[model samples]
Target: MESLIDKDRIQVKFSAENQFAAIEMAAKPLWEQGYVDEGFLAAVMERERNFPTGLPTRVGVALPHTEAKYVIKEGISILTLDKPVLFAGMGNPKEKVLVEILFLLAIKNPAKQLGVLQTIITIIQNEMVLKKIKGAKDPKTIYNLINQFI
Candidate 1:
């Protein structure tokens, strides 16, 4: 779980002007920890522009990620915002969603990305888990919830 979810890297009640800043905020720790390259943030921003990762799940989350080229190590950066941020819905440019959670993925292995994403999707789709996340007051609680699932 340390490799996937760095407890210290988790952000609770995170604030940002927009999704791009939120992504930069989320990716900072991973970058400082040597998990991702300098290009990680830029690549993610470009990817989001061309193809949004926002999901209209039970909790309204976004899964922003880029190619393995931007990754030095595999990890997931979770940010639970203080307020919901609007993001273009995935595969639906016309639609917009207020996302409270962001999962910024930095995966060095392309083959493992799908499985990891699927696991996260499964977690996000679970009503109980979504409830727990939305109700969580701090990073420890959120981290604990993920630990339970993982």
Candidate 2:
């Protein structure tokens, strides 16, 4: 997974005014690089709208993803915001979360999503890693930090 991800796929301190903008920013990398098809962004956004992906972790994060049928390859587009953005909470649609990080998941295999999300959940629970990621000075550093776990 480490070798598969390019540093450019990881962004740092990006300014996304809202969750949709943030979703677009994160999903762009995968489709632009041919990791997924053009419909991926729309699919992810639709899924997000119907069933939110926000999680109130140690450092808030949103995991926006769609069905495997929409994916051509596997990739995770990561974005860290300049300021926290609002997203409806995953557990409760009526609730909101201030998200600083977004992981746009493109998994070609449906079964893999669970395992990948488990790893993501682990990363979310680890405050030390999230803090390091939030404070990262460059995209390469963020890439390295995520590579350590996934």
Best by TM-score: 2
The window of 10 residues in a row where model 2 has the poorest summed lDDT is 1-10
Q: lDDT by residue for model 2 over 14-96, one digit each (tens)?
A: 99979999999998888788888888889999999999999998788999999888888788888999899999999799989
How far in Å is the alpha carbon of 59 misplaced in model 1?
Answer: 1.5
Q: How many Å off is the CA of 16 in candidate 1?
A: 1.4
Q: What lDDT would each prediction earn against the true structure?
A: 0.86, 0.87
lDDT of 1 at 80: 86
Writing each residue's lDDT as its tens digit, candidate 1 over 29-119 gives 8899999988889999999999998898877899999999888878888888888898999989778988889889988777788778878
TM-score of every candidate: 0.94, 0.95
Where does candidate 2 clash, by residue pair?
none
Question: Clash totals for all models, in order?
Answer: 0, 0
Q: Which numbered prediction scores highest in lDDT against the true structure? A: 2
How well does model 1 score by local distance difference test?
A: 0.86
| Model 1 superposed RMSD (Cα) | 1.3
TM-score of 2: 0.95
